[model samples]
Target: MNRDPSGGACAAEQLVEAGVRPTRPRLAIMEAIRTGATRHLTPEAFHRELADGGVHLSLATVYNTLNHFSEVGLLRRVGFGDRSYYCTNAAEHHHFYDEATGRLEDIPGAQPQVVCLPEAPPGMEIDGVEVIVKLRRSRQYPR
Candidate 1:
């Protein structure tokens, strides 16, 4: 619907653009992920949605496609500790997580504080920072 006249090929086209094969399962999963306004998605949640649509894409396929997208920089993984979440990489400046509701929100133009160590005893390199801002609803009610 992005106005590509190819017809039934936009999703597949995006796949190829992301350096992935334009396969049926990948296209279908991509549609499912792009259904909502929010770009964030988890493979588990995506699998459930696909199942609801009667699509029999294996979980392995789902994970693989997600990884493929991630590898190609079309998607990004968001998580805290060990819980993993997924999001499209249109703009991944930052994120916010609601502890009470389990919801994830994108934060635009955020720069986190990065402190440097005094010395490195061995060979090591530091990657970019991944900040997870956890938030919760205040218990006290207004009114």
Candidate 2:
């Protein structure tokens, strides 16, 4: 899928393909997420961005839209501490989170090898694994 946010047509088509209605608010929210300087954003941050872009959406609306998108596989919802971040790239992948800056970046092409795992309980199965590597500047080599 095209990652460029400028491609509104692509986003609209994606929304439809994900079985979601391509409404104005949904389209705008998707575009904002795709076009954001940072690909990962919290609902509060998204609300601020949409408001700044003149796409006045309620905070509740933004949260609900993001959750819906995540549910439809249009986005990925990642949890960090007490907050949740919506990632535009829904593909299964790892991430590096900078604790100091609260920034989350994709760990490109690096899928950690999981050698073994305990068997799941009866009637349950392991769905997927998510790895989040936390990073912090060392005092000796602070940036």
Measured against the true structure, the TM-scores of the candidates, in listed sequence, are: 0.75, 0.86
Model 1 scores a C-alpha lDDT of 0.71
What digit string (tens of lDDT, one per residue) describes model 1 on residues 41-139?
Answer: 778888888899988888889988887777776677776766777776445467888887677777766556557745544796654467778887766
Cα displacement (Å) at residue 117, model 2: 2.2
Lowest-scoring 10 consecutive residues by lDDT in candidate 1?
Answer: 1-10
Per-residue CA lDDT of model 2 for 1-143, tens digit only, reads 33763344577887888898989999898777776454887899879988988999899999999999989887788986797988887888878999988999888875777778889999999977778999999899966
* Candidate 2 worst ten-residue window by lDDT: 1-10
**What ranges in model 2 sit over 4 Å off?**
5-9
Each prediction's RMSD over C-alphas, in Å, is 4.4, 2.7
**What C-alpha lDDT do the candidate models reach, one value each?**
0.71, 0.83
